[model samples]
Target: MKERMEKRVLVLNLDHTPVGIVNVQKALVLTFLEKATSLVHFDYLEIRTVDRIFPYPAVIRLYEYKNIPYKGVMLNRNNLFKRDQHTCQYCGGDKRLTLDHVIPRSKGGKSSWKNLVTACHRCNTLKGDKTPEQAGMTLRTLPFRPTLSYFLAEYAERHAAEWLPFLEVKPVG
Candidate 1:
């Protein structure tokens, strides 16, 4: 099956400071219809705004906006494995890894971020067709969907380190 086009949220800031990213559809609508100005970077647009009037127009000012394209979903196997550095969840060893359904598929485990984990060949084979409880294995941490902010922070940390100074991310803990 063909994969669906991934939608992105645009990160915006006023007065060269951090704000939040809005859905691309919303951003575009605001830009085209609402006359929201776009923030231009070297070659890419860093952000766009819903409001256009500002103190300055040419330089990055209080009314200025930038767009940071939205990154993919965070805290899935991609995020977990990225966070875990691709080590086997069961052994913490560097080896070939596969996805383990925390709840076995036979038990109505749907393929989703909350239901999948990284496992080594041994763990996957040993767990075989059985639930973690049945296999006598325990998960180190429960899987969950990460909030948009969490993923945004992660994306900024990895790709746009300089953005940290501009963005204010509220601490989750």
Candidate 2:
């Protein structure tokens, strides 16, 4: 039960902008060290050790503001699939997916967000080593870097809905 409660915790920067997710144990350690404070607890959940009882933290904020240097999300295969929601940018196919360069690398297109996209094996093979334009394919959407808030919000999704207000950056109806 204790281990289960220690599984996840949302961590926020001093500005109240979410930075990432951490385990509840890490959150507790931060709170103990005066490095962070709990913002809220999950309903009907508590952590009890031999010494005392404590509320199970759902969200926590750091005491000091760290620049975190704006090095955005990594440019990698898994991130590409996640950014595109596992759908082929071309033809919208959903199986045997692979990465495709919008402007083929052979033509000097760097492996960056703007140049990369998710594509099913069929589309990838059909348009091998050529620009999508040359292969007569159309991208469903242009790929770009997701905002930090949006990226962290995706991680918060596995937690409680109460986290929505804390992670909220963009307007929602």
Candidate 3:
């Protein structure tokens, strides 16, 4: 049987950094209803309740008034893999992609995004039951939670192209 796709939400930094991803259904409601906003690379794009309205970037920055660290959330696999662009974390190879556990289950790894990574079978077996140091492997990028904006951007680009303008971002070229 085909597996069900897990849903995700978007995570936004107070500074509007697309720090990580969240479940989709939650993000949709947040964005569509103006309860939440989208975080682009540099700023938070506000969701307008009324037509033709735009959010002021200055207002969002003023509201935060503090520097905050990065945050993230769980997202779907397709989206996760896409965010990683199907590159294997172990060797940076892009073929025979598979999910890997940074920390093995025997070592108390949970089946979660922060613990999981995209890898090739060779890397998976090589790194099995041992930490990266023990296995002589190093991650190209540290695994962390994804921002909601990343998920939304991915979702809209692939699933709802029409929403791009409403999102106030250029369509993926």
- Residues 48-140, model 2: lDDT tens digits: 889998998888999999778777778889888887889999989889999998998889998888889999999999999888888998999
TM-score ranking from best candidate downward: 2, 1, 3
RMSD of each: 9.8, 3.4, 10.5
Per-candidate TM-scores read: 0.49, 0.81, 0.49
The lowest-lDDT stretch of 10 consecutive residues in candidate 3 is: 56-65
**Candidate 1, 1-173: lDDT as tens digits:** 01111233334455454346554445555555644564532134333347662221111222445565645355455776754447776677668788888888898998877788788889889999988788888776666554455556666676544345445455232
RMSD from true fold, candidate 2: 3.4
Q: Which lDDT tens digits does candidate 3 get at residues 1-173?
A: 01111323335445444334444445555556765654432133333445664432211111232355535445566655776769988898888877887888899988876787888888888898898988999998877666555456667677444334334242221
Candidate 3 residues lying further than 4 Å off, grouped into runs, are 1-76, 154-173
Best by lDDT: 2
Query: Whose TM-score is greatest here?
Result: 2
